[model samples]
Target chain A: MMTLKKIAVPVAALILFGLFWEFLVWVNGWPNYKMASPSDLWPAFWKFRWLFLDYGWDTLWRTVAGLLIAVVVGVLLGMVMGFSRTMRDALYPLLVGFNAIPKATVVPIIALMFVGQHDMNTILIAFLISFFPIAVSVSIGLSTLEPEYRDILAALGASKLTIFWKIALPKTLPEFFGALKVAVTLAFIGTNLMEIVEPHGRGLGHLFDSGKISADYPLMFAVLIALAVMGILLYYIVVALEHVFAGWAERTPQ
Target chain B: MTDLIDIKGVRHAYKTASGPLPVLDGLDVAVPEGGFAAVVGPSGCGKSTLTRLIAGLMMPDAGEVLLQGKPVTGPRATVGMAFQNPVLLEWRTILQNVMLPLEIVPTKMSKAQQEERARSLLALVGLEGFEDKRPSELSGGMRQRASLCRAIVHKPEVLILDEPFGALDAFTREDLWQTMHRVKAEEPFTGVLITHDLRESIFLADQVVVLSGRPARTQYVMDIPGKGPRDLEELYTPEAAERLNILRQQIRIAQGRAAA
Candidate 1:
């Protein structure tokens, strides 16, 4: 009953929001080209569902590829930073500085370099944008390799690599997964940014650009709805993976 | 009996930003093979440091820490240690945690053989059904029990315990004192326990060594009256009470909390 009430409030709020948007457009005497109402947007969504799926699939795969590369690179760099103080001092500031730069500005430069291959630019830019959080989290996790646990391993005569494999990696899993959830969202942001920079890279961003140029307001709102749902779907996939990999965490009493 | 663990004229100190903070100065400790010895001292007197030195986790500044008459330059695989906290890997099952040391130090024993030993050790500690449970699932007492099992599963020549029950409630701590005694009795490893509780030390240790304040040096050593077949009830006897009082007084003086 409580959970149902929780669901009911959100659904009711959504309905009120849709009605409010409809009323605002009506009050302004906005034309169809300027604004899309709930009624018009619903039917338009059904009509362009296939197109949304095609472009959504493209965006999703590019995000996944970018995130995959980010995981590999970020984890390697994070390990180097975590273990070696000298290397961390050398590389950490550079990573933070690189991460600080505007990814949007970088995307155009990448698009220029790749030219017609905007898809590669999209993935590369997405990877660049999403790399830092995972690397930083992994380094933090490795560094926090509990002193007590390390001492126990040391007392047992476990070598450095053995200690890492036995204690550090397993200890860092929750942090790794936590970083993944954040990285996935950042990856989606980068994908959308790149697609907007070069609409030739097929995705919801391209559809959004086409909607604007043609002034197909209903189609534009529909694409926006599709992008939101796709983001939600991908985020929940990472959440489910977290459950699979770190289920013991859920069962932890404290 | 030969000394399984021996520290002669050992001096250890840590460097702080302020200056050098001395902890142990010309300290000596020895435990005979298969004997359980407890080192009791004022808090912050570096009792844990003593355990670390014996385990070869740290190099002593000026003297030799020997296990079976060889200098301990680094952590030797034959030294097993269990700290106050259980420190079991949360990701591993109790059985797997017990079997962890075998993975670190290569053993000729087959996986199946080591596994059987792990299971048996868990069973010995009354954790048979809990073999598959993660450390977080168990109570604090149970986790510490598992930690003890893990330390002994590899059958180290010397087992170093740093206040294994210091965090437990009085009742649980007492319960585990029996458990500790039982484990030591059964396994017969040369044992060194670092604890604050004098009763606990007297109840479990064959000889209780008391140390003085900072830059700790042995002030006194009480041979708890027993060779074998000791009981907890014996702790309350007049002779034991006098000994316990002496031990407490010595530690009190060591901590500068009371007159000698």
Candidate 2:
């Protein structure tokens, strides 16, 4: 009952939003080619369901593969950078400098290098854009042990390896989860944005580009709907992982 | 009695914008083996610094701290210490926290034996059922007890407690005095406590060492004559009350000298 009431307000608001959207389309008096109502987008979803599924699978697998690469490289590099002063000073500024460059601009260079393999282009773009956040989060997690806890462990003669396993690694889980929340969404955004760069590609971004040229507004709306659903699904997965690893953390606020 | 832990003419300071802010000025302390010594001083009197200094957590700039007749150049791997805060890691369960030292420092005991020791230590502290509980689930006093258990589980040569009960309420603080005594009795380790409470010093230790103000020295050391079970009623008795008053007066005199 509590859960139902909790969702009731947002559900009602969505219904009103759908009504308002249909009313606006009706008042515009434009044909379905120019404008789409909620009802029109609904059937269009069923009509292009296969196109949506296939393209979505392609984009998702690329994004996830890229995200996996980012996690591996990011965490390893972050740990090394955190442990050594020389490595941190050498790599941190370069990383920040690289992160500063708009990843979308890197797409054309990556696209040229890959030359017609948009799948590779999409994955590279996603990995390049999303990797830095995970790196920064992991480094911060490694750095921020409470002095007393460190001292207590030190007094017990804990070596760096022990400290990493007992203290640094557990503290990093929350930050890794937090960064994953941002990086995963940005991975999808990166793939789609890069996909639009090479519109001859086969992802949702290319489909949207084609729909725009053909003036099929409902089809574009259908792509937007799929993107929204996919983003929520990805975000919830990270949130679930956060709960699994850092569940003891929910009670305390720091 | 042989001195097991020694701080010899220790001179240390922290650097600041103005200049060097001196803490310990030719300060000295010695604790015999299997003895409990409680240190009492004013706020900011370098009491905590003295604890760290003896524990080898921090080095003295111009002097040396020796444990077991050898200079302590780094954290004494076998030294067990606890602060006012439990300082228990949030990520680890109470059992894991207690077992931490065994994992870090090489132990002769098997895994099962080490775990058995941790469980028994928790039970000794009245936290038997809470071995699996996270530090956050326990109350402040319970957490401190768990921290105490963690400190002694490894059975170190020395136990340095810096205001271990300072944060607790009066009732809880009194309760833990008994708990502290009971634990120390069960496992005899050289104990050094840095605290602001004279009564706690008298109640918990065989000898109470008082410190002067900043850039502190050992101003006075008084032996509290008692054995076996300690009772709250004893603290209010004329002799114990008078001893506490003398210690309080000694601290005021030390502070006065520091002010001068």
Model 2 over residues B1-260: C-alpha lDDT tens digits?
A: 44998888889999999999998897878888887899988789898888888777788899878888899988866899899988888878999988888877778999999999999988887888999999988999999999998888889999999999989999999999988878877888898998888889999899898888888888888988776558888889999988988887898888785321
- CAPRI-wise, candidate 2 is medium
DockQ of each: 0.75, 0.71
Best model per DockQ? 1
True contacts kept of each: 0.83, 0.81
Model 2, residue B3: distance off in Å is 1.8
**TM-scores for the candidates:** 0.91, 0.89
List the per-model TM-score of the A chain.
Answer: 0.88, 0.90
TM-score of each model's chain B: 0.96, 0.95
